[model samples]
Target: MKKKLGAYLTNRKIMATALLALTLALSACGNSGEKANEGSADKETRDITIKIGYQKYGTINILKADGALDKRLSEERNIKIEWIEFPGGPQLLEALNVGSLDLGHTGEAPPIFAQAAGAPLVYLAHEPASPQSEGIIVPKGSPIKSVADLKGKTVVLNKGSNVHYLLVKQLEKAGVDYKDIEVKFLPPADARAAFEKGSVDAWVIWDPFLAAAQTATGGTILVDGTDVVSNHEFYLATRAFAEKYPDIVDILLEEADKIDVWSKDHPQELAEKLSPQLGIDVESLLLAAGRRNYGVQPIDEELIKAQQAIADTFFNLELIPKKLDINDAILK
Candidate 1:
């Protein structure tokens, strides 16, 4: 009887030990499976960073200042934004070419030159032409009175900028040959310096620089873009970036449109917000904000044709190495 009882106890102890081991093994397997799922979740939730290039002033600046883009992209998509500022559109497009920027804003001309230079860019949207936003200005007491009077005189402008097309068209209207004037290609800062020193006969510039020049120097407007050029501001992105993350592009445009709506309704508030970002006083910024026509529209047939005309003009003048079909750079 004692041997049988001992045998039963031994068997029971063995069964208990086996059960404990099995429980621990199952728990370990469950932990491993959980870890695998967590790894996948980490991968899926990783944040995406988008690099955006912008100029000193414009809707992009307003967008950046508003902080709505960053907030929306972060909360909704787990995406991060990186903002880069360029001196001008040409420089911005150059960064796009080198893959440093995923998206950026520019006036009409820079993209044309960039496209001709083989930058794989796609236009996303554009602001309607704000003709009075840019102009040719001479100092307060300069002898140069009209666009036609710029003949054989030195004119400074940012090369391959929106104002570049403006200068060309205005000169054509005044019956001045492109070669007749001594053209000096300088960025806005340098051009303004030269203008102040009377080194350049006239400065072809866009606002807030135009407004600043006019306010500070009391310069007279020789000719603005009125009835001359459609100085459209474009939103551009690299082909790869746009193709891989189209949703991000759409979000950006949507946010920009929102800012545009807000800006158009609140000019004083817009100027106040932009004054610090642009480093221009509120008055000049107000002038710039006033003249600016704000709206974000998709690239359409008429817009494309207008852009193509600019491209053709550049090609005919040998400003670009090759002719460009503006449609090629447009987002489908």
Candidate 2:
């Protein structure tokens, strides 16, 4: 009877140990499945595309050509990228308003116009001012020497553009009354034609158009925006995109910053790369790229105030349809 009891106790001990081992094994399987499912869920969440609007020039073009953003966003971040080209910022912002594009870069004036038009957009980042990038140009060796000479002259420029502000500020500084000048609103191509034909006294323009005109037509710079207007370029995103994917915005801005560094470091290489892409000569490309300051910056109070001043200027001049509070458009 003692032997039987000892054997029974040993059997019970073995059975208990076996049950604990089985429980642990099953628990491990359950945890493994949970982890696998969690990973799958993360992948499912990230199966989305970011659409970007770009012009034929600038940092975005360089980035697109390099395929850096495409590789980083698609392969590493698990987000697809779509590139949509627009003729200019105004058209790009129109796409943003209609939900066609998630993000874009543009001149300072576009967002103000977009805001006034009631587009839901936010300023994401900015390129440092490149005042020398845009300017008023005259035919090479023309007698019209100074900004004061522009008074009572028919000057052609894109209406409501960043350069428009430059022209206004420069005119004021030169003691040229705004009403004294006959301003013709022309797109860059037409403006270039008019400028070359002497139909207009001067053409207000920006690079690589500025570079091209100077090279192609021997256009001379009368005055640039230096110490006048900042001519800062802004990166803008639709309100919906920014709110939904702040991380993605960060990623894009970081990429832009990288390109900024790259462009500054490799100006000659950049000119070489962009020459074919922009259909402009390498020398002209170098000139345009060299003058531009390519750093990206976050939105801040001082920048907002500067933008507010622009908004006010346009509003007072009745350029925009309504009074716009620039603060309302800035992303928090």
Clashes of each: 0, 0
For candidate 1, what is the lDDT?
0.86
Candidate 1 local lDDT, 176-217, one digit each (tens):
999999999998999989999999899999989999999988
Clash pairs (backbone) in predicted model 1? none
The C-alpha RMSD of each candidate to the native structure, in angstroms, is 17.2, 15.2
Would you list the clashing residue pairs of candidate 2? none
**lDDT, residue 45, model 1:** 30
- Scanning candidate 1 in windows of ten residues, the lowest lDDT window is 37-46
